[model samples]
Target: MLKAGDKLPQFEGLNQDGETVRSEQLIGKKLVIFFYPQANTPTCTVEACNLSDNYSKLEKAGFQLLGISGDSVKKQKNFHSKFAFPYDLIADESHEILEKFGVWQEKTTFGKTYMGIVRTTFIFDEKGICERVIEKVTSKTAAEQILEA
Candidate 1:
């Protein structure tokens, strides 16, 4: 997975509203990109909502938040509206973005192995250099974790 000191890779994808969002547009902001397993799942919702609840706090600290998942555009749109999230959610259904970040990997569940997304959040500085990576994310305190990171 992407780590501290790595460059934020160039990416462009359809957002929840079906509009294209590009990484180049985030050039001058401190970006927090959280890659979740999927949309609307219990834990994912908690983390997203926590960030939404603390949007102002993060913004005040000069951080811009984004969420990405291997979900469809329609699903991402629904999730965004359902929670009224303040940040854009990327529908990386093709797994292109997930793969680029190295979050897509093999995992074992119930003694069976399968490919899946491991939850992670990458914090990047204004110049697009990764500053921190939160791999063991705390769903309920995600915003606090980001801030402290």
Candidate 2:
């Protein structure tokens, strides 16, 4: 898992709109890059919605948000539209960004183990340095976690 003070890894992925989003574009701004296990799931929805509900506060605090998941662009689009999120959700179906950010890992459920994304969020400072890493994310209070960090 990435920790505070680590440099943001170089990455690029397609957003829900199929537009290219690159880490370089966020270099000079504070950013909240959240990694969710899947889109539209109950917990994921709460998390995404929490952020959306508090988006104005986040923006006022000088931060932009991005959500990344292995869901396809169509699914991401649906999720985004369904929730009316004010931020972009990247379709990282290729897992390139997932691996780069170290969120891809072995997960177990119902006695089955498999590789999947661990719910995590990386907050970066204006210079692209990691400022905080939230690994034990509280979906219902995600935005508060970021704001109070």
Candidate 3:
């Protein structure tokens, strides 16, 4: 798992619009980078909607939000449209960025085990250094915690 003060790894991936978004491009700005398991699933939807609802507040606080998932760009587009998400959703189909951040892990539920993304959020300072990592998020108040952080 990445920790506070660790330098973010360099990576490039596609966003919902198929536009290339590079990690280095987020430098010189505060960023809220979040990782979720899948698109349109219950938990994922709630988490995403929470962020979408408070997007103005988050942006007003000078934080740019970027959501990453293993879904393809096409799926990401559908999710964004369905949820009316105002922020960027990166399609990390290869899990390259997910692996780099160490959010991909072995998980088990209902006697089923599989590799998946553990809901994670990284707060990066304007200098592109990690300020904090939210290892497990299970509530909508996550945005509040992030804003307070």
Candidate 4:
């Protein structure tokens, strides 16, 4: 698992617009990469909106935000359009990114166990070194926590 001070693993993925987003592009900016299960769900919506609400602040603080999920580009595009989020939403349908970041895991809900992506966020500084890893994220407060980190 990634932790504070560890260099982030290099990655390349497509944004909501199907544009390329690479780790190299984030060379000199603080990055807040949050991983969620899917788009348009209750918790995911809350998390995305919460970050959207404070996007200006995060930008002002020199942070570039990105969200990743296993959802398709079409679904992500719709969610982005509806919420008007000014950040990148990467499509990770193959689960490669999820596995790379160690967010893919076996989870249990109401006595049923299954594999899924755990909601988590990684904070990386301009140097691409992780500054914080939020393992237990509350959708509403996630942005504030990243800001503080």
Off by over 4 Å in 2: none
> Weakest 10 consecutive residues, lDDT, candidate 1?
140-149
Cα lDDT of model 3 by residue, 16-115, tens digit? 9999999989998799999998999988898999988898999999999999999999999999999889888999988899999999999999999999
Indicate which candidate wins on lDDT: 2
Model 4, 67-86: lDDT tens digits are: 99999988989999999999
TM-scores for all candidates: the values are 0.98, 0.98, 0.96, 0.96
CA lDDT, every model vs. true structure: 0.95, 0.96, 0.91, 0.91
Q: lDDT tens string, model 2, 13-56?
A: 99999999989998888999999999999999999999999999
Error of model 2, residue 23, in angstroms: 0.7
Give the backbone clash total of model 2.
Answer: 0
How does model 3 fare in lDDT? 0.91
Candidate 1: list runs displaced more than 4 Å.
Answer: none
Error of 2 at 133 (Å): 0.3
